[model samples]
Target: MTLILWTALGYLLGSIPFGVAITRVLGLGDLRQIGSGNIGATNVLRTGNKPAAFATLLLDSGKGAIAVLLARHFGGETAAMLAGGAAFLGHCFPVWLGFRGGKGVATFLGTLIALHWPLGLIACGVWLLSAVISRISSLSALLAAALSPVFAWAIGRADLVLVSLFMAVLIFARHRANIARLLDGSEPRIGRGKP
Candidate 1:
């Protein structure tokens, strides 16, 4: 029951839709009507509002981190992992948005960082390097997420491997369209706006 409550809390936090709120508050119009129509920082950037995009990124990441931290404080590592995974689910399938939401990249990294900072940093580095090489956001995110479980194992965090693998699977599932585009060479590069 306590774990259930923590998971609920995590989901609620992750479903806040910071991108929509920030864009609407700044009079930038509805986030859903712009770019890829994704409620993530990458889509937020399509509005040409760097500050709003940055804010959305920070808040989106913070929600995942906070969920993990809070659960860990109250219920130990298992709860923390469950809560973090719940948060990622919420981000990807937010109930408030008719179950449609972001791809979970930022939230994934945030949850990873909260669970284990070194692993998170390494994942982030992988993402950065991939992005620089491919200039493709989805590909970079996929690469980072796919490698996280391996990184966790290599770093001696066996307990975290399953959670990392779970998140990676979900991330890949959510980015199905992007994957299709990637395969066909039609995916847009970073800062090139929506595909």
Candidate 2:
């Protein structure tokens, strides 16, 4: 019952849709009508409002981290893991948005950071390096998710491997369309409007 409650709390936090709120509050229009129609930082960047996009990213990631930290504080590592995973699910399939939401990259990284900072930092490094080289947001996210488990294992955090794998799978599942575009070399770059 406690676990269920923590999970619920995590989901609710993750489902806040910071991108939509920030964009709407700033009079940037509806986020859903923008590029890719995603409620993640990358899509928020399409609004041409760097501050709003940055804010959305921080809030989205913060929700996941906060969920994990809160659960850990109240219920130990098990609850923290469950809450973190739930947060990622909420970000990917937010109930408020008819189960359609972001791809879970930011939430994943944030959750990882909360669970283990070193692992999280390594994953972030992977993402940054990939983004710099590829200039593709989806690809960078994919690479980071894909490599998280390996990094966790390398750093002796065997406990994080399974959760990292689970999040990676979900991230891949959510980015199916982006994967298709990437394969065909049609995936859009970071800042442009279209492919």
Candidate 3:
């Protein structure tokens, strides 16, 4: 019962799509119509609203961090990780949004930060470097997710290895369409840069 409650709480928290909500509240219409139809920060940027995009990014990460923190406070250490994972899953497949949700990268990063501050900072660095080099947000997100588990394990967070690795997989999976576009050399680059 407790586990179910944790998962439900986590999912409910994650289902709150900040990008879509913010856009709607601000009379921006359906965010899905503007960009890649994703409710993530990258898509929000496609709207050319830098401030909104930035807010979406921060809020998305905050959702995951808050879930983990709440779990740690009310449940336990393992529960924190579990709730974080549940939040990622929710972001990937939100029930309130027809099971079509944002990619899990932002949420995963937040989860990492909640678990280990240094690892989170390193992951963000890697992500920024990848984005600058490839100019593809998807690629950057993938690389960051891929490296997160390594950093977590290397830092003696063996208990978090499996969870973080699982998170990596989930984030990677959420980028399936981007992966296809990347392979076809048609993926859109980050910001207004070249593809």
Q: Which of the two candidates, 1 or 3, achieves a greater TM-score against the reference?
A: 1
Error of 1 at 166 (Å): 1.0
Q: Which runs in model 1 stand beyond 4 Å of their true positions?
A: none
Question: How would you encode candidate 3's per-residue C-alpha lDDT over 32-135 as one tens digit per residue?
Answer: 77778899888888877889989999999989899989988898887888888888888888888999999988888898898777888889999999998889
- Deviating ranges (above 4 Å) for candidate 3: 193-195
Each prediction's whole-model lDDT (CA) = 0.93, 0.93, 0.86
Tens digits of per-residue lDDT for model 2 on 1-195?
Answer: 999999999998888888988999999998999999999999999989888889888999999999999999999998999899999999999989999899999999999999999999999999999999999999999999999999989999899999999999999999999999999999999998865
TM-scores of the candidates in the order shown: 0.97, 0.98, 0.94
Q: How much lDDT does candidate 1 score?
A: 0.93
Root-mean-square deviation of every model: 0.9, 0.8, 1.6
TM-score of 1: 0.97
* Model 1 per-residue lDDT tens digits across residues 74-153: 99888999899999889998999999899999999999999999999999999999999999989999999999999999
Clashes of 2: 0
Give the worst 10-residue stretch by lDDT in candidate 3.
Answer: 186-195
Clashes of each: 0, 0, 0
lDDT of 2: 0.93
